[model samples]
Target: MIEMSWPQVSARRLERAGLGAGRPATGTGLATVEGPAEGPVEGPVEGPVEDIVAAMCGAHAQVMSAAEASIGLRADGVTRAHVRAALWGEGRSLVKTHGPRGTVHLLPARDLPMWVSAMSSLPGAHTAAPKSIRMTAEQTDQVVAAIREVLAPAAMTIDELSEAVIAATGPWAGDLVMPAFQGWWPRWRMVMHVAAHRGAFVFGPVRGRKVTYTAAPELAPVTDGLGALVRRYLAAYGPATPDQFAQWAGGPVKWAAQAFSAEELEEVVFEGKRAWVLAGDTEVPADPPRGVRLLPYFDAYVVAGRPRELLYPGAAAARALNGGQAGNFPVLLVDGVVGGVWHQRRSGSKIDITVEPLGDLTAAQLRELDEQVDRVGEVMEGRPRLTIGPVTVGGHA
Candidate 1:
């Protein structure tokens, strides 16, 4: 392996790149309320939602509502309607699919070829089946083939699809059950991701309260390799370690090293540890923009960045993370670092926001926070109600 340490880069410059400070780049999700605010931060970037998704690699969509807000904050004149239209409307340009870390994400349809190729190549990608629900290699192949055969002509709900899998593959596939957040899900559902990773399935529009699955639209072949995806990741959230890359990509460290080696990466010190950035990207902005944002649960910005201590320091870290996991509560970003944690609840037409700062806040910072609160309401199409107080972080308030 090649290694050479370059001059140290300031955290501020690294944050500027990670936060998408000047031009359109990265941000967060969610809503909250306490008091009415004057107005919103004017003129958010205006562009196609797909462009924003592509820029961040992908927006975490485990919570569909939060994902919508994440995209709205980045795109100009975007509303819940625009997000829905882009997702399922005629000429749709995006798809909700399983992404890195096996989490749901809103990825640009145009880039599905690249995502499919890179994600499917990850080590242990096909070995998620636990012993209790274990399938022989040949049986796993049968399951994947059955999924393609059943969903090729029409969309199906999980229950309906599970039935089809059992019909095609026999009783063993349907007999398996696995514990999941929503309850005990059929073990067959676990391997369903295999079909998605192979570009054979994607989330279709909601049929009432249940999510449906459909055949993925055919995408033009992409010649880019896994290294290309790694390059984009470094561009948006770089100056990071290979292990961090593996964690973010939900893959093996060996794969990460291979991808990093393929790029002309330059070494730099991030808080005393060796990290890397793309060659020629070492020039830091003299004055990176200073601002605040409310990032939602599982927002891409919170998930992909490394060296969590720097990003969420001191008490802020305690408030924003639990058991080493982030996104339990929406976070408050003051000048690109996590300064506080927040939560929001809506009643009728009014939305209530509660914010808990890690330390003292200036009057000016509080006012700017109100403005951000208003922006959250605007994105959710609801009235803002702001309340400042102590907030308990891990899980819903």
Candidate 2:
């Protein structure tokens, strides 16, 4: 394998490779979308739902609205309705499930086999759980079986599912309490994702304000395992270190090290530290990415990119990050780097956007930012109005 140093891997080149900047390039095992203008947005962009999900490894869906915008920006003529249809339509192609970092994400349904196999291969955590709340392996299995049984015929809300789990496993399963941001939640709620990870259940349609669950159809296991997952990650966001991969996948560093040890990888330096990339991915684009983009909260680029200091840098970091976490604020990306943070509020048919730049923006940059705001409006299907200045994170003012 060839090895190189940090200076050789420019941020501009890395951004081009990772973000699919400029015209979309194929042959990375990702599907690409092609079409014409639909709404106010221009050009034929690459979208095709499966391709977008594959390119990002998975789109974060903890904030559903943000997730929609993430896909809308990448896809040609994709709207919130289209995304909803993809998720809930009769011929569903995407699944909302617990993914990397124990966070919810939208993954291609057909890729579940690889996901299931790779996620299941991680070594079990060595730490012991509290007996009061911890379910034994057999007990966990029983709970999963109970969930599958309850949802096999029809989908049910968490409350109904909790009751069913208690009925199937006895009241003890619901008796344990775990503290959460919303308040104390039943211990049984904790294992819901565990069931999801094991392919027992998946998020179903919302019933009014309540989220429901349903049985997941069986999928054939993928022959390739952790190694394949690592390759996919590298393909999407590479020149990355093992620890970064571990953090993104919510697995142990040792597991990442073992998985990445396979020989196809080419070693390279990133800011004096070591990283690796797929052998074929080493070439950098000659031209740099231009234009501004309004990336929604938890956008894949913001969430998955590493070397935080380099990506965020100085004041941009302070405004965009909340307690060292990246998703608290919607960010403004100027040439693939965080230039500022922004927030938006809607009233009737008009949306007001407020921008907080880390420093002064040139006249041209401001004009580009305005165009980006218009794009945001198109994605939201609303009339967008701009208010350039400091804006709070979390909520719009």
Lowest summed lDDT across 10 adjacent residues in model 1 is found at 30-39
Using lDDT as the measure, the top candidate is: 2
Per-residue C-alpha lDDT of model 2 across residues 72-154, encoded as one tens digit per residue: 77644666777788889876778888888767898877667767777766665443557667767777778888888888999
**Per-residue lDDT of candidate 1, residues 249-301 (tens digit):** 88889888988887788887665678888775665545544666777777777
Among all candidates shown, the one with the greatest TM-score: 2
Off by more than 4 A, model 1: 1-47, 125-132, 181-183, 392-397
Stretches of model 2 off by over 4 angstroms after superposition:
1-47, 125-131, 395-397
What's each prediction's clash count? 14, 1
- TM-scores of the candidates are 0.86, 0.87
